[model samples]
Target: MAGGFGAIAGLLGRPSREPRLLLVHRLDERDPGDPGDPEDPGAGPPRSLLVTHPRAVPSESRGGHTLALAAPLTRVTNAALAPATNLDQTPLVRASRSMMAGLLSDLDHDGRRFGLGIDDVLLSLLRGIVLEHPDASRTAPPEATTATRLRAFIEARHTDSRLDVAQVARELGISRRQLHRHAPDGGVAAMLAERRLATARDLLAAHRALTVAEVAERSGFGTASRLRAQLARRAGGTPKAIRQAASA
Candidate 1:
């Protein structure tokens, strides 16, 4: 199941009550040949920066590197300058820049009031880099294997009520079994159910004007009864209860 544009727009229109950002900076060279750990006075220091929201951390080494910033777009909603290196010397640099540019463009164009869809942008960038980069074999992220494809499929059809395992498999040109194998245990059906529930929950929490049945239909549940049953089973609350709580 997926969210409708109206539901998504409503979620986007809300104020930035919860703003989180994740900044990841990995050393271009994972295997630097210094056996002595610097902190231990025998091996070299590990190079990485995993910073959380609203926090800026400084690094000691000012080496040429690739940086990925994943944050809620509201914090930096305006067009901002990001550093880019020449990819001709380093192929990964070029791939990273291309991926980032596509994301920034999407943010500039389609973002709602609170922020851009950074999660969707990041997912799209990762998928493109993994599938299209020439040297993907050398530096591709490990999680880029199945999760990326699954995410791409979901994002592509996040608004379509008819999206199911069969439809997804047909579009991706893979077998149903292959799609299930790509997903975690309990497989595609379970994943789809979870996504639908999450979308419904977001809408319920944010949109006071929408009815329970409207949210259900918008989030891709076939009928209000089915939505109610699923919400009760998964959330331990009725749709009406959830909506009331949200309003309260």
Candidate 2:
């Protein structure tokens, strides 16, 4: 069980903050030995520890390849217990496999390898699950659509100095209220913040010539102070430090 979990974690890129334990034996075979018999169920299922944050996995990438999977507690339990069973028998498992195959196909189409880093693979798996089985109340919720639009908006205006929510709403022909409605969970501001910070980190790692302010602006943060605060809070370092580390 540990080996399986480790393999999946390696594929998905486990985050530093979460505590994850992977059980390795095939579900159809004997017990994996390290069953997570936590004393408390209210604390959350063992799998919950694997994905505590929504952005724990990076959803989009320059490589244009990602896969997502979300299995129901029951399904996950079954899979963990019996690895030899075909996941397709269950709706969640089938959906997850389909999503993974599609992602792999996209990567293959783009002439990229299907192999993804752990974080990306993990994000892809969860995305597939959420997309296929949103909560009944969240049915038709604008999250997926809004995320797509926001991603497009970010990509288009990655270099713009005035890339605020208002402008993004205007460009998308939607009011700020409507955009906010589309992302009620975190709203546009949170999404943009995450996107910009991630982009800034990527740029800092990739380019030495770009200044901190330049990286901030290009990444949609608008200012170095905002970027710095965000980096300190979420990325745990100053932009300069991130760049310096990248260079080193």
Highest-lDDT candidate: 1
Q: Which one is best on TM-score?
A: 1
**Candidate 1 similarity to native, TM-score:** 0.44
- On residues 1-248, what C-alpha lDDT tens digit does candidate 1 reach at each position? 01222222233345664332333333343434455445554323333322232212343323434345444422222111122111122344344454554555666788733322444456444334333423322333465566656764564454456778898788767898888878888787777777788778887777767777777776777577867888878788887787778788
TM-score of 2: 0.39
Regions of candidate 2 where Cα sits further than 4 Å from its true position: 1-147
Q: Candidate 2 overall Cα lDDT vs. reference? A: 0.50
Q: Which tens-of-lDDT digit does each residue in 1-248 have in candidate 2?
A: 12233344463344443222221112222112434455632322112122322333233211222233333222121111211111212344444445555655676678664432433454445434434432301223344476555555554354455767787788877888888887647777777677778788988888767788877876777788888998998778897798779878
Q: State each model's CA lDDT, in order.
A: 0.52, 0.50
